[model samples]
Target: MKATKRQYAYYTGMFMILVVALYGIFLLTGKSFIWEGDGLAQHYPILEKFYTWLHQGSLTGWSWDLGLGADKLTTFSYYVLGDPFSYLIAFFPKGRLELGYNLLILLRLYASGLAFLFFARQRSFKPASQLVGTLAYTFAGYSLYVSIRHPFFLLPMILFPLLAYGIDHVLSGKSWIPLAIFTGLALISN
Candidate 1:
């Protein structure tokens, strides 16, 4: 039991160290690792539109911001602007949107790492090997690239491992709560 605790502590410490290093490297250089490409540039405008709606004492009415005021249903049907967690961005002040967004990316990346770690451990991989795989999986080229190019798509990727794990456990006679929670999160996240 003690050894497992020690192992988890080590894994957590290593993961956090990597997080700080990566963030520091990009942030201190006046650049961003996760927001560099089309994702932030493209999505921020839409997110701000949602924010504007919230502050206007409206959630989902016709948007006057569109061409001669198209229906707000366009935002819901065509874009991730309807995602529940997207409202989390509105909590940030206008000037701090970048900070909030980058933080969300970082949090998702670390959560992805932890999910991979859980999956590997469940498959009976050794602890050290699990940590290595977790780090590699989280920071792999595909994830980094997609996070910048297609962040809306990346939301599913983050929850996939966890959702599967939760379902597997439920199937194996464990409680169903975890599975239900992850499923809701996956469906509503984006």
Candidate 2:
């Protein structure tokens, strides 16, 4: 189904409302989204290191920070290096990483909704059904569970719908490139 501008606007607005409804309390109270466990002790620090590296324009070599020193790129590659969204951290100033971290989680969730919408639209789902499915997929229990505690996991969730759409394209006698590209992205995102 061809989506009109009005439908796009409606979907976008609805997505924002859903996000705000779910997370607005914390925002209003100025509470940190960091999960106090792995999020505070591990993820945020790793992300701060990544930000420092990016800000310094040097993402190579060893760092003593990782327990008596480790290869910077190699260590980070297991965490943020492969996720494309992690690169956005460079835009956040040094002191405001916590805010950036929280905002990025929201952005990732929104992107997940958009990915699901793209898949539903490609499959010709009705507009209302598309909206419902997008919202459900975006706000699913697993998605919410991982958003704060394991934000990188959202990368796979976001890519899964696109990968499914690419599979549809290939099965319908289209070029295999889309499937291949999506597969590569899904793999690299992890």
Candidate 3:
């Protein structure tokens, strides 16, 4: 028997609900309160330094003495560009940055799921095939591994399918500059 449209929507909704519940459980059981590795906190100094820079107009980097000769400030320099996300994080109350980061994780997971669904639709998969494809991506091994490691890396993975779809739309000559800028912003946003 073929699944009706309502049945498919029900299945998709249930799957999304389950994904969110699983993500919450996963967040609760992680090694650290925020699930980001030790290297994540290494940016704290830079965060403080950025707040100082905002008020003082200093041009120096986070710290010349912080890390090893070459590797010390490399990670912090990732934010040296005008990305305001970190600044936003720093603006919140001192103890609430973890909450902010946790919200970012949830958003990343949702975006990853949507990206998988877009990919499945692009492939014209049958309902079951699409379900499998979405599940494969949204719950893949890398998801588990990344949860314990550099969790933010998921942002790029989440944007991959959507960016591909937009680029394809542009290359088909239906549109150009919008997709180009969209993809470029996705790259820069990370």
Q: Highest lDDT among the candidates is held by which one?
A: 2
- Per-residue alpha-carbon lDDT of candidate 3 for residues 2-110, written as tens digits (9 for 90 to 100): 5555534754686667656666665566533253444366433455555555555554545454554334235554653334344455455656556655554555665
By TM-score, the better pick of 1 and 2 is: 2
Model 1 CA lDDT for position 65: 68
Full ranking by TM-score: 2, 1, 3
What digit string (tens of lDDT, one per residue) describes model 1 on residues 1-190? Answer: 6966776677778877877775577767887544545655667666667667767767666766676887775655445553545667768898887776676666667667777777677777777887788888888887777666655556665688888889788888989998899888776565
State the TM-score for model 3. Answer: 0.61
lDDT of 1: 0.70
Tens digits of lDDT, candidate 2, 61-176: 98887898999888888789998888998998888899899988999998998888888888777889888888899999999999988988898888989999999998999999
Residue 164, model 3: Cα distance from true site in angstroms: 1.4
Itemize residue pairs with steric clashes in candidate 1: none
What RMSD, rounded to one decimal, does every model reach? 3.2, 1.6, 5.7
Better of 1 and 3 by TM-score: 1
Once fitted onto the true fold, the runs of candidate 1 whose alpha carbons sit more than 4 angstroms away are 1-9, 20-25, 33-37, 73-85, 170-177
- Rank candidates, lDDT, best first: 2, 1, 3
Q: TM-score of the candidate numbered 1? A: 0.76
Supply candidate 2's per-residue lDDT for 154: 91
